[model samples]
Target: MKNTLLICLFVFAALSCKAQNIIPVEDFFDYQNEIPDGTYIKDINNVLNKFTGTWLGSYDNKNYEIVVEEVVYQSQIRTSLTYDQLHLRYKITDANGTILLNTLPLPDDNDYVAMGQYVNPSGAYQLDYAGYEYDCGQSGTLFIKTFNDNTQMKLYLYLGESPYNEDDCPNGFAEQEFPTNSQMLLTKQ
Candidate 1:
């Protein structure tokens, strides 16, 4: 009887603890009470303007450039391709005058914007090139140092896995034995 009673009490205690652990969605975020001063907002805008110009650089002997055509704060998501919930959008182009990529500013929902593909696996958000999908892995400490305001370089340190999937290379893709590294350099256009 005592054992049964103890079990019931334990279950009740566990249920109680679980109930206490749950947090209401409404209470998850605490809204800020005060608005920012005008000067502070202006300073932020100035800093943003610094990031709004064209940047140019090179990586792996391939020249690249990016033109920040538009900057939007608190941007709304009209569509997935055009000005979604991103802070900014920079029209990117390569040296050969080919449209290479698009740079979207960081999203409020995520901790980091897909910055030059240092930490994305599926390569869904990375700049795609012919025959090679660059910057598509979870990056380590060395990856962060490659990023700079003027010239951004991303290195996909391929340990051993094939960068191309079976669908990409169907002719029985050869297994990679050594670590391969690919670099992408972005400069403001």
Candidate 2:
């Protein structure tokens, strides 16, 4: 009887450990509750659909303009948008035809995660690389206005202070006030 009880306790402990590691799908869908009942939901989906492609833009800092290109692709229906940002040097491709400076795949799966910001109907948000969770502290709205089938404009607004502002790298850049608009001209490939 004692041996059986010990085995049960060990099983219970093991299950508890596994539960701690499990991330529920609901956590990632927290933004769903913020969506309005009617028209807003469809509007969100429309904006997200427009985001599926390659976007190229430049950030000018007086003297130097860094040409940045971002390639975004949707995963399976429920999967998060996976993307990579590359510096457009002389040529775009790496030795293996992959984009240069591509982000390494996350350990959870063989998928590359985007750095900087990601905006969906759920809201403008930032993903935590170390913990692999959607951070509530970095919430904002990404307003995307479609001009046509080929042209769209994006405005990213951080509702509050940006969580990344404290760091010194890309993750640490300061959040701009509302209407920090950036335009992208996408040529579907």
Candidate 3:
């Protein structure tokens, strides 16, 4: 009788612990018709794993260094859903080795940090980018595509124009440290 009671208690305890439902990262949008409130959208195929690491590149005499990392169970921007996403931090330096812009020291939640949004049908990864100068229209969508056996990637920025009062700018808008509407090749370091 005592053994049976212990078994029942153990089963009850096991049942009491709720496990989170896991959905493959690729299937995130397919479930839009029915919202899976607390499900985890994960990279079960390890696609994003290959992109996690340091990438180095250069453009117009400026050196760019980006670090990619996977963040698991990150809460969605405006919902109860959680998912695994890529986090990007970068540092740009001038030809003379002077720092132009650096976001490596910022926290993951900082506005300057780029957050992964989704992968498109063409297998290109998209991320929401907000630079330190976002208030002046330095924010946009960033696209990354892996190539050459995942050792190289192409980074492109599509700047989204933000509406700001004309009076805010006395000397006009400053050019982005990174390229806008163009792509740069990066090699995994």
Model 3 TM-score, 2 decimals: 0.84
| Residue 82 alpha-carbon offset, candidate 3, angstroms | 1.1
lDDT preference between candidates 1 and 2, better one: 2
Candidate whose lDDT is highest:
3
Evaluate candidate 1 by giving its C-alpha RMSD to the native, one decimal. 15.9
Per-prediction TM-score: 0.29, 0.30, 0.84
Q: Which ten contiguous residues of candidate 1 have the minimum total lDDT?
A: 78-87
Residue-level error in angstroms, candidate 2, position 59: 2.5
Clashing pairs in 1: 54-188, 54-189, 55-187, 55-188, 55-189, 56-187, 56-188, 66-189
Q: Give residue 184's error in model 2 in angstroms.
A: 6.1
Displacement of the residue 51 alpha carbon in candidate 1, Å? 0.9
Give, for candidate 2, the lowest lDDT window spanning 10 residues.
Answer: 58-67
Please state every model's RMSD to the true fold in angstroms: 15.9, 13.6, 3.4
lDDT value, residue 181 of candidate 1: 62
Residue 145 of candidate 3: its Cα lDDT?
86
Could you tell me the TM-score of candidate 1?
0.29
Candidate 3 C-alpha lDDT tens digits along 37-136: 6666778888788788999999989999999999964574646677788989999998899998999999988878899976777777788997766666
